[model samples]
Target: MKKILSILCFLICVNAFSQILSSNLEKKTLALGEVNHFIIKIDNLNNQQVSAAAKNELLPFHFEEIKDSIGTQPNLYERKIDFSVYEEGKFTIPELEFKVGDKVLKTIPYEIEVINTAQKGDQINDIMNNKEVKLEPKDYWELYKWYVLAALSVIALIVVIFMIVKWGRNKKSSPVVATNQTLKELDSLKKKKYIEEGNYRSFYVELLDISRKFITKQYNVPADVLLTDDLVQLMKTNNTISRDNEKIVEDVFLRGDLVKFAKTFPDKEIMEKDFTDIREFVKRSSNDLEFENLRKDV
Candidate 1:
């Protein structure tokens, strides 16, 4: 009996504290207009980090917290939240999320039970004021027909202007020096917040665009419209890019296709490697272009 009891206790303790965070309410059942406390304790904080205002989305309840309280120890974290109910029967306390690096931890949904405390005499006024009325749908087509037409006309004009502007741009030739523009765009890409926000597809698309545009402008070939396999074959046929540079561009294009069309999200390490490959590919391809320039100058 003692051994069995010890094992059960150990299991209970392990189950209780194994999670990254735990939340509990001081009193789940409270009278309306009464305040109670809710607390959250986080463990293993030394091994992970979380957003500073992690609980912002879970709160601003029916009534605000009495005090904003937070405390931390060497490897432990706790936040005390006091909230009051105004009018409620059963309400769900929103779920909370804690982001540790790239992973998000979510707590189970919590519900609060609030019992109305107002007496019959206090509710008499509310009962007297209660009334029901039918909601009849009205036809607003006649009232706003001209207004809708005017709004749509404005939208059509804007779209026509946008298309005209786009067409003008397409007819103009780019005059940017390939090497300088490629490096400039790469620096601009690094400053973008897409990778930080997990927008892998957008980042990859822009990276690949710079690559294909550079190839097209420098080689005077239409590289952007070709499929990845076809582009690789064309490069090999024309000796446009070295075997190593061809691999780098092909790999980036394949990865970008997967991310943009397949909706596959790559982790941070894969994204960082792709960024490095893009830089190297641009540099090597630029060197090839420079060699062609030197040959012509000769």
Candidate 2:
């Protein structure tokens, strides 16, 4: 009888201890706006390793294992709960139940109070105004028409002024008088015979000036201000002369530069070649306009 009584007392003590271990819970409280944290630690009382699947029955919360170097136990699981609520009221974090094989463990409920924050700016007014506002289509064509009319008026005024000036110039002068004046100036210079006297540098300079003047009068190109390269590029872009004619023009300018700037003494043959190139260029270009006019007349 004494032996049976001792066994019953030992069994009751063991059951009480098991109930106390299973009912262990960790509870926490925090403000709504504040960062809230809760931790539930479970020490593995069993001899075997425990899995996190044992805590899957928790509501409104979840648990993750924590790695701690100071703990002697191998399976010390930690469950952390973060409470996040925007409303200003009391909220409850439900109890959690973790199952490991045949045994179950329960965790306590957590509570948090959420409060409203003070907001600045006219946010409600801006939202109401934006919702009521209506956009109207812009009339761009009406605005553009005035600009187009103004541009046309300016162009017409310029054309009238140009016509009046051109008509006055043509009416006051004769073509024959202009032609005679230019020819007489050239003739007087030729009679000076500066080139035949071996003044090659001066001769080339005068030739370049005369060619520039003729081009300015005949083609309306600003030949006096143009460099040889600029003139060549212009001629090529304009297709003003044939390939053969362009080569002749280039050679004349190059040879003239050598004589005037480099002080190059050319033989009689080269001097004669330069004169021939100049004469041919002038004759060909001058005749082209008349030929074009005749074709138009026909």
Candidate 3:
């Protein structure tokens, strides 16, 4: 009888100090940019206070976190946190520690798989695929009438100017080279703050445009007209730009293409690196071009 009583007392004591910690995710897999719900529950709190340090918690990059609850009941404690990652990949939620009076309880880490929803099936479509909509004839007329009127007005103005000057002598003027235009434009691009605004696609498009234009003018290569692969090939053939610099340009173009076409958003560190490398590439290439011109003049 005494042994039985002792066993019961031991069980009671264990229950008083013991806590049940469990972490649950609504789904292990999610579509890109979709929120995943996570819940943490603790039972048998025994009236002891439960608290978690905010500084100890860390989330994946670009993942939005929404804390729903830090619930407390007579013997129960629950926390709900929602997380969503803009980029697709496998991400983990690290173990969270909760202080219960003197002791700390930690939850196990959870892995989340994020996949692109648009590329789920065997059939692959463009990320920016245009959907066709059937419209009435009146709708087409309504949309295009203003454009037609604008085009006709432009044509009439051109015809009038041409008739006024039947034949004109062309004057050849010396072209003025704009100094450090690409670097100045890069500074202007920074002022726009497209990345901070979450307009990554626009940022990449403009970044590529600026780089391509610089390459075209500096190397006399049609970088703006060539495809990314073709332009990278052209850069590879250039003896003036070092192989390392060529790789930097190639990486930037390829990553930019992914952002523009595949809807991929890289971390800010990579974006900053691309910006820095492009600036370096432009500076070095500009100096090389000037040196070549000086040698030719000599």
Candidate 4:
């Protein structure tokens, strides 16, 4: 009775082990550019190990195994394949074969369909070869009119050149009499001892006027009409002086305004500095481009 009972138990275990080796896949159809996944269940009987391998003839794909428990009962293994197809046709995913000990299992064959869009008719060549219509040329008389106009322009140019040359010679022969007169007036203003006598208002006003006359004679600019800010802004815009000279010009005018209108009393040192600044500004303007032609005669 003991022998017979042991034999029955051995047969029962073998039958249970064979059943665990069998597996099944989820689907057999897929669309192009889609991912298809399936699970494989293996009964780990007789201490058997499970592994998977694949071969494909048409489509490119990837496969991966899923994790499961390793208990006495059968466990599930998963496989995933990605199908990215460009052409319109049916494609086979090939077979994914799994091996467990001496037993071999295969996943079901899969089919994928790739659809393509229709193309429009060709109109590119028609547009590329299209040309515009040309206009007819003008008559000979119209062409002759352009030559007559050009000849007249040359004569006008010659007459203008003669006048310019005559003017240049005259200018070279004569000194800039206006600049000389303005300088003499400035020298007279400098000779006055108004600031020394504590007449700050008269001194600043006359100093500014002399400087303005010099600028007007030398640069042909109306300095008398421009305020201190306007003068500085104009110089900066025209790039007439260096940044340092611009600051000096601004300081001289601003200080002169304070002494004249505000009746602000400055020390002897400041009075001397203002006098020097005004003299220097006049000398600089006398040498600028507007006065350069006159300077050549001198």
Off by over 4 Å in 3: 1-179, 290-298
CA lDDT of every candidate: 0.73, 0.57, 0.75, 0.58
Q: Which stretches of candidate 4 lie over 4 Å from their true place?
A: 1-179, 242-244, 290-298
The C-alpha local distance difference test score for the whole of candidate 2 amounts to 0.57
Worst 10 residues of 3 by lDDT: 170-179
Clashing pairs in 3: none
All candidates: TM-score:
0.40, 0.38, 0.40, 0.37
> Candidate 4: how large is its RMSD?
35.6
Model 3 over residues 1-298: C-alpha lDDT tens digits? 9999999999999977799888888988888878778888998888988756332133444557755557789789988878777777888776666767777788787888888877446776598979999999999989999999999999999998897678755552211242278888999988898766656666788999999887777677798899999888777775555676678888999999766542345656777788889988887775666565687799
lDDT of 4 by residue, 146-255 (tens): 89899999999999899988775544312256556656876786678876765666777887787676665555566779988888788778765546556776887788
Query: Per-residue lDDT for 69-159 in model 1, tens only?
Result: 8787757777787788777678876556555556666556677788987676764345476678654444467667799999999999999
Which 10-residue window of candidate 1 scores lowest in summed lDDT?
51-60
Top model number, lDDT? 3
Model 2: per-residue Cα lDDT over 131-232, one tens digit each = 554434445556587998999999999998999887855443432443455455555656767657655656677777776776656555677899888987
Of models 1 and 2, which has the larger TM-score?
A: 1
For model 4, name the residue pairs that clash: 20-43
